[model samples]
Target chain A: MYRLTGVTKRYRRGDETVDALSGVDLVIEGGSQLVIQGPAGGGKTTLLQMLGGLDRPTEGSVELDGTDLARLPEPRLTRIRSESIGFVFRTVNLIPALTALENVETALVPLGLAAAQRRQQAAEALESVGLAEHRDGLPGELSGGQRQRVAVARALVKRPKVLLADEPTGDLDEDARDEVMSLLEGLWRAHGLTFVVVTHDSAIARRAPRLATVRKGRVAVRERGPAR
Target chain B: MFFTYLRRELRCHAKAALAVALGLALGIGLVITVSSVASGMRQAQGRVLQSRYGLGTDLTVTKAATPPTRGSTPTFDFAGQSGSSARGDDLVTVQGSRSLDASVVSAVTGQSGVADAAGGLSLRVVKADRRFTQGQARQGGDATGVINGQHGFGGYGGVTAGQSGGGTAGQGGGSRFDADDYRAYGVDVSRPDIGPLTSARITSGTGFSAAQADGRVAVVDSGYARRNNLAVGRSFTVSGSTFKIIGVAAASADPAAEVYLPLHQAQALANATGKVSTVYVRATDAQHIGTARSAIQKNIPGTDVTTSAELAAAVSGSLTTAANLATNAGRWLSLAALAVAFLAAGLSTSSAVGRRVREFGTLRTLGWSSGRVVRQVMGEALVNALVGGALGIALGLAAAYAVSCVSPTLTAQVADAPGSGGLDQGGKAVGDVLHIALTAPVSAATLAVAVALAVGGGLVAGGCGGWRAARLRPADALRPADALRPAA
Candidate 1:
């Protein structure tokens, strides 16, 4: 469960100020899948970053499970990200130096898992995304779709309570995009994970149980649909 | 965990570690070499002073003051009696010329703190062949003719031809013979109370007996006999008097060079009567030197008095300037080693840090505090320094032992010198082995200094890397490293 009350994020660009998100108030219950749809500069990524405890909102509060992530110390927030939140980025998703399996194992490092168990869990996570055979391959050696799948595996390896994906299918072909979306949805449905996906893809938006379209710095529209 | 990290660091930068080790080794080597040499020289000076010259004594007074400039010999004026006049040279020139003055000597010897006393004489003499007219034939030759013929013959002989007489040619061609005149006054050699001649070594025959010491028998130096082609059991005539050579003693070719004979015989030979130049008083302890000096100054007046330590210091001080230059030269070389070590530590640490920026960044992001990162880097540096230092100490000690072994003079000097306990003395070979072992720990100090420099250098490198990493935003850090370009 997460809540944001009057959350505002701003950035200083030399002499000028830029508002990435402002006056945003929203809430999502536990075990819900939410899609944030917006074109470039719609502050979707900024909103997701703030919600994932990777960055703090400039004003108001973003709370997760009744704990205000905005007010937590940076170290504590990093620990929360490692323990409770997993992220899938559009580009630079997996650490290039590590194989798909090692990238997944990296996430479990913060969890204090023994090396053998971490490797086993990483393997299972890769298998879940149908990438078990390619687990030993590096990101540079994988296809665009395969790399995205590896990213998803790394995020899910820790079994985090919330999964945040920003343009997870941005770089993949349409067919590969569908397969990745299907895998994400299957994991969300089977594990009852809270999924917050930031994307401009209408097909992804249509598939989510709930959708919100962001314009400028505010949420302009919301829609509900069947989970399947 | 610390060691694991250090091992990884060293493995990653193997070349740099080797360079550092080599540099440190050189520093250690230099320190060991210089220290050993200085130690050896100091030891040598001490041994020469102690063994060859009975260096531990107070006042060595002679009738003549130390050469070139002479002091007034002490005069004795009996209270309520006439002043006594004795030839300065006659009184102390020969070993026992002043024996009859036992009444006056006993009066002075009875003084408090006197301990024990004796008198002797010293002189220089020339050894030449004695040519005689056995069957009433004309026989005559100058000192130079006799000296040249003796030298040309290469052995003692009765006569030879083409020998030139005394002149500059004589001075250049023949060796000058010198002798020591000594005497025991009213003292029995068998008496423990008598202060015996402490530093004499008789290579053959025996030292003077109380009775024989008063006779014309004399002990010549081994070098003196060898140079003069004289042998023990042979007789030689000096000043028309023949004296048999009874013993040959080892003699120091220093200021104390001389042949030993009874003072009475020496005085008679020199044709001086009732005269003595020196009075040797052996005190009970070193503390009595000053009291004896003051009493003698009061009773005899103007007598120069010195302690054994003072004598040793004075004698050693005369040679210390050269020794000090040698010691300082060694120290300067050691300083150069330190400089080289510093450079090596710096270059290696810098190269290592330059290659590990990414690892450092990972550590920072992994919640390893900045202080811990610095410590790990410094620990790696310390490990390198220690290895190099240990090797250097071994090398240095080995060198010292080798040098001592090759030179007996050096070994004796080291053995006899005060404050030479640290020197390797198990002969030359054992000393060489022990030198390396002993110097190893000392070389460790040099390594420690190098390690400290390396750690400091590492901190500087770490500080620069830390500043760069600290400036990056977390989002930037997590972004693709290539995409997260460094800020200009």
Candidate 2:
């Protein structure tokens, strides 16, 4: 579970101090899915950064499982980010030099797993994403949809408690985006993970059981309709 | 995973890696070539010194030659000889050196740091053989005629007091004179290892035996022996005493003498029974030759002592110039090249890191520690350095080998430079000019230094790139590329 109390994030661009996040409160129960929607630069990605422990809030506290992430030391924060949070960027960002399988294995490296076990787990994760046959292919050799699948495998391979994805299908076409969304919906339900996604797509937002809209660094939560 | 990533990254950026390696290789190759040449120069200089000083002679003691008195020329008088031909010889001490007391050798040997000392008498023998017809008186009239057989103006016998009467000498009465001169060194047979004999290697027969310390046997120099048609078992007369040629010697560079004799016999011929022209001293430690020279000089005042270093300073020629170039300009040039190479490598690495900002940021977001990222960057840099080091070593070895193959001859004038006051201080010219082949030898130590430089260069380049990678923030990857771009 994550609890946010008066969360605020500020950025200094020269002499101007712009507020990327404002004092907004929210709570997210474990094993629940939430989709955040907002305009460009409306603090959508900033809010995701806070939830993933990638960045600290300027004011107030962000508690994950009752531990305040904003106040945690950098090493402890990194450890929590490594062991508890998994992130998927809008860009696939797979290492171009590594094979698809090796790309997925990178996430498990921080977990200190044995090489054989890491390989086994990475293969299984790739199989789950339907990219098991393309395990040895480089990202350049894979198509747009296949590369994103590798990224998804890399994110979920470590089995973190929370999966924070920033514009996961923003660069994909309609078909690929729907395919990725369905894959994420199925994986979330199967893993019982706390899934939070930041996207501009209304279709993706409508399918979430809970929705949060961020504007001017403040969030407004609403109960969502039934799943599509 | 670390290795795989590093390997793949280097392969992806092969051009950049190769550029860095080639730069480092150029620097290391220059260093090796310059140092190896310098080492070869030192070896050549040592050979020049050994020519005159001999193998074990570390210092030499002598007194400056006294100015010759007027009318000191050798005279040949054939008076009261029964035969038609008369032969006579004169032995003179070597020029540019005065005799030292024979005891000076023992005194130098007793000095601190002095291992052994031997005295040698350097002399020159001038042999004159002449034939003359006895003057006969003949009567003639008028114009004064010449008489060529007599000594004192032919006795002016061509004219009489009253009438001009000519006196004609007998037919075939003109005198013929033949002269020969050769250098001879008197060796201390008991301790020949520390004297002039050390400079010559006997090529035929046997050298002096201990029992023959005062014997009438002599060793002849090969060149002089060939000229005189003298061989072992042949006899040569010096100052009316005959000595049997027992051996022939050949010198590597400067032949010390035309003939070598026992000290007692040479002393007897020169009429200086207890005198030596030079005292060659050997030191217990070659490194302490200066100390031994000082001790010998202090023990015997008014005597000049010369060391090998003093002789080297007196040498001048192309060899010295090349040595200077290798030591000064070559070293500085190599160092400058290396500095530039290292700087280029560092800047290139830093630029590579900048281009990979997105990639490094994504790795950070994936929970890779700062240390792990840094290690990956450094691993790639290390591989480049090692490859460059190997290439540099091969280039250096090839360059050195080529130099040896060419073997250009360098001329060195040792210990005979004008205005070198050392000559008067018992430092004799070993050879007026020597031709030594230049060689570049790569020593083990030079290679070791090359390897160390390669490793150090790698570390420097790696540190630059790793610092940039380690400072990246994981959150930066979450923002859009344009969003993170700073406002201009």
Candidate 3:
């Protein structure tokens, strides 16, 4: 579960102040899938970053599983991210040098898993995403869809309480995007994972059971729909 | 984890690692090479002075006889202008009449810890040929015949005969020879324990016997014999008295190109009966050298005693003044090594850190503590330094060996001899040259210098990188791919 009460984030741009997030109040129940749909600068990525405890708000409070993220020290916040939050980036889909399996294993490094168990878990994570044959292939050697699948495997390998994906399919084609979205939904259903995807695709946004639209650094709309 | 990271970093930055290693190798290699040469040369010079000047023993004593003092009265020119001229003072004035008898020297020999004793009569001898005037000849020349008989001449005519022939001569010639004079006086040649007068290497024959020791036999140095064409088994008459040449001795630091003979024979030949100018005494062991010296001085009364080590030190001090010019000349090489090492580390580390700025920014955004990041970077630097230092040490030692092999003059300077044949076999083990003769472990001081350079380089790198990473806004780091903007 995550909650943000009147959260505000401001940046000093020389003489003017730019509000990245202003007076934002939101909440999500456990095991729920949410998509924040917005344009490039509509603060959707900012909201996702705050929910994952990667950044602190200047005002108001962000609570993750009832713990205030703004009050946590940096190391503790890192621990929270390590144990409770998994991130999927659009560009850095996986570390370029590491294989798909190793990319998954990297998420387990902070978890203090044995090498053998980490390897097994990483292989299983890749298999779950139908990338078992490509487990040892580096991100650079993989197709765009495969890279996105590896990123999804890496996100799910840690078995975190929440998964934050910032434009997970932004670089993929329409067909590859559907496959990536399907893989994400499959993992979400199989493991009961809470997903927050920041995407500009309204079609992908409509698939989520709950959708929030961000405009001008504020949540402008929220709607519920059947899971697709 | 540390090693893993180190290995990864090294693999990724192979060029930077190699650059650092090469810098360290050259720097430390030069240090070891130069230090080895310097230490080796010092030891070599020390050995030459010690062996030639009788520096093996601990004590020596000369009879207390005041040197002649210059008169205060000024000399007058033809104009009757009375003034002191630089040449007016006779630099070679001889004085002191009180001489120690052989018995007194023998008494010093009887003291505890006294290993051997030698009595010497020092006098300036004028050469007959004047080809080499003012040459010093030791009263006895018998020992010279036993070692390098080719160099010793028997009689006074034999000296001229040997000189004219300029080759090996017939035995028992008993000819009056024209060899140079100016000899150092010592006890019988059979005594090997005498301080400061021990024969380093016998070029021709055995030392003098008691009969020849008390007789007219003498041992001349190789330098004097070579110059005068003296040979063994020849007799040379001095002052109308014929003396046999038994052996020829090599010249060392003994009285600046002098010859050697039995003390009594020299005393008899000099016509200064019952006079002893100096005495050589050796201590039984190093520890008792001082005690023996003090006891001899006390017994002799009014005599100044010195040790062979003290004499060697005196000679070394004099020689160091001349050699200081050479040592100072090599300092520029050391400065160059330092400069190369410093610059290499600076450039390599700066470039490496510059490339990793984005990675460091990501780590900082991921909540890595500043201290942790600093430690990680410094750890990488330490790894580089240690590896580089190890390579440097190996290369330096090899360079030192190569230098020694290439330059025999350097070996001679280090070993204190021409051949250095015995030096190879003399110490505990061969090629153990590094430990005693060349570079000792204490010479690892170069490693510390290297590490210091690396640390300084790492700090600069880390500081620049950390400053750049810390200036990044967290929002930019966490933004979506399309939304994220590069930092100003």
Candidate 4:
């Protein structure tokens, strides 16, 4: 579970102080799915970053699983990100130098898994995303959708409690987008994961049981489906 | 993990590795070749000096020769001289005398450092024509010295050669034909005090007995013997005396001594009887050679006293140019080359890190700490250095061998240690001078120094690369530049 109490993020741009997020409060429960929708520069990614323990609030506090993430030291924050958080970006950010399976295996390195176990887990995760035959293919050699699937596999390979995706379908064709949406929903339902997606795609936002529309550094509207 | 990352990185950037390696190899190769040359010259010089000093005799002291004033000493009219003068004229020419005989020898032998002393005459026969034949049966044996221009044993000054005869003719027809000439030295090889001859490595016959006074026995030098077709026991005639050849000995410090005779006989042959010109002294211990040399110089004021070390140094003079280059210019050149290799490696690695920021950020996001990333870069540098050092050593040794093959022997003029005043100038002899031969040996010490240099260069470059990577923040680095706008 994650909680943000009156959280704010401010950055100095030369002579001006800009508020990336201000006076926002939110809570994310275990195994829950949340979608944040906003136009460009609408603080959607910042909100997701704060919830995922990637950044700290300028004031107030961010707590994840009962630990105050805003006050945590860098090392403990890094540990939380490594063991509990997984990320998928719009660019299908699998390392181009590694194969699909090896990219997934990389997330397990910090866990100190044996090489054999790591490989087995990576292969299984790739298979779960329907990329079993393409485990050995490099990101550059795979199609847009396959690369996105590889990214998804990499994220799930760690078996983190929470998964965060930012514009996951931004660069993919409609078919790849559809496949990624289906995979994300299936993983969320089957594995009891806490899923948070930041996107402008209305269809992805519609699929989430809970949705929050952000405007001007603040959440303006919240929606919950029957499933939530 | 470090090694795995290093392997993948090297494969991706092999060009950089090869470029650095090639640069290091060139510098290392030059250093090895020069070091080997200097080492070889030292070894060869050591051998020559050892042979020149001769065995058992640690110091040589010979009296200065008088100007013979052989022709005439010209008086200069200092008030506007008319004659043409050459550059670098000799001022204050010291007069020499054949006075280093009994008294001087006795004086040196009695000095505190002197353990023993032997004196002998060294001179050339003025009229050793063909009449210079075998000695009588009462003497040691027979005398038969070479007598021909073909043998390079021609008459000295204007001495005419005569027909070969049985000494009876020497009492009569002495100047009809031109006879060969021979440089004669008088020494008792059996006496440890008598240097030059005492250390003669006998290739054939034997030496004179200390008790034997027959005086007709001789020791022919190896080179002179080879030229004159003389063997042990062969009789030769010189200065009208026949000596039965005792042993064909290796040449002494001065290679031009073609014939060696008993001290008494040498005194008689040069017709300077009861007089010896040079006295060689032996010290009690090796370390005391210098002490003895100094004492002898002080005891016999006008004598040239040269110790074995000084003799050795004289041969080393031939390699003065090479030694200077190796010691002075060579060090700076090697350092510059190393600096070049290090600078290029650092700059290239820094640039490489700049290009791979996203990759590094990805590693960071995947749980690699900043320290681990720096270690990866450092490990890559160290591995490259090790490989490059190995390659450089191999290439360096090869270059040394190639240099040695092209230049095996180097010749230099031997300026006898300041003292050999009355002794023959060894360099003046035809076909003989101080020869410093070379054989480059790659000592393990040299290899160790080279390897250390290579490693040091690599570490320097690695440090630069690591420093560049240490300042990057993964979150900001991973984000695209267009995503920098203020969030809504």
- Candidate achieving the largest TM-score: 2
Candidate 4 ranges beyond 4 A from true positions: A5-17, A39-60, A70-73, A212-221, A226-228, B1-4, B37-225, B228-319, B408-410, B422-439, B481-488
**Per-residue alpha-carbon lDDT of candidate 3 for residues B1-488, written as tens digits (9 for 90 to 100):** 33444566676678877877677667666666556655555655565556544545466565553443487322222221222112211111011233566576788889878877766555444333211111222333333321111222322221221222234432322212233435444454455555334645667876666556567776667777777678787766554556666777766533222556676666665566666665667688888897898788777687767666555444333234323433565446865875677566656665665566544434443344545555666666666666666676677677766756664432222121111111233341111111112222324564565456545544544454444445444445444335533222
Q: What is the TM-score of chain A alone in each candidate?
A: 0.96, 0.97, 0.96, 0.96
TM-score per candidate, chains pooled:
0.52, 0.81, 0.62, 0.69
> Model 1, range B1-488, lDDT digits (tens) per residue?
45644675577467767777767767766777666665555554544554323433454332322222244332222122112222222222222122223233454466556776655444334332222221111234453433232222222322423334433222112222123232212112332223223454678877677777567676666776787676778876655666687877675423133455666666666554444344456666777877876776677643444445544454333234445655787788777776767665755565555555544533333333445556666677677766666666666667666755664331222111111112233322111111111111223454455455444443444444434444444444443333312222
- Is 2 or 4 the stronger prediction by TM-score? 2
- In order, the B-chain TM-scores come to 0.49, 0.76, 0.53, 0.62
lDDT of each: 0.59, 0.80, 0.61, 0.69
lDDT of 4 by residue, B222-269 (tens): 888888899997997764577899889876545425677887777666
Report how far residue A15 has shifted in candidate 1, in Å: 3.3
In model 4, how large is the Cα lDDT of residue B204?
Answer: 90
Candidate 2 lDDT tens digits, A208-227: 78999999888999987643
**Whose lDDT is higher: candidate 1's or candidate 2's?**
2
Model 3 — TM-score against the truth?
0.62
Q: Write the per-residue lDDT of candidate 4 for residues A1-228, one digit (tens) a residue.
A: 888889888765666777778888888788988888987877787787787666677777888888998898877776777788888888766766577888888788777888889899999999999999999887778999999998888888888888989889999888889989889889988988889898888887766778887777787546566545
lDDT of 2 by residue, B383-483 (tens): 88877888888888998898899987888887531111224335444446778899999999999999998888888888998998888777764466666
Assess each model's interface with DockQ, reporting 2 decimals per model. Answer: 0.14, 0.42, 0.31, 0.32
Docking class for candidate 4 = acceptable
True contacts kept of each: 0.03, 0.49, 0.08, 0.19
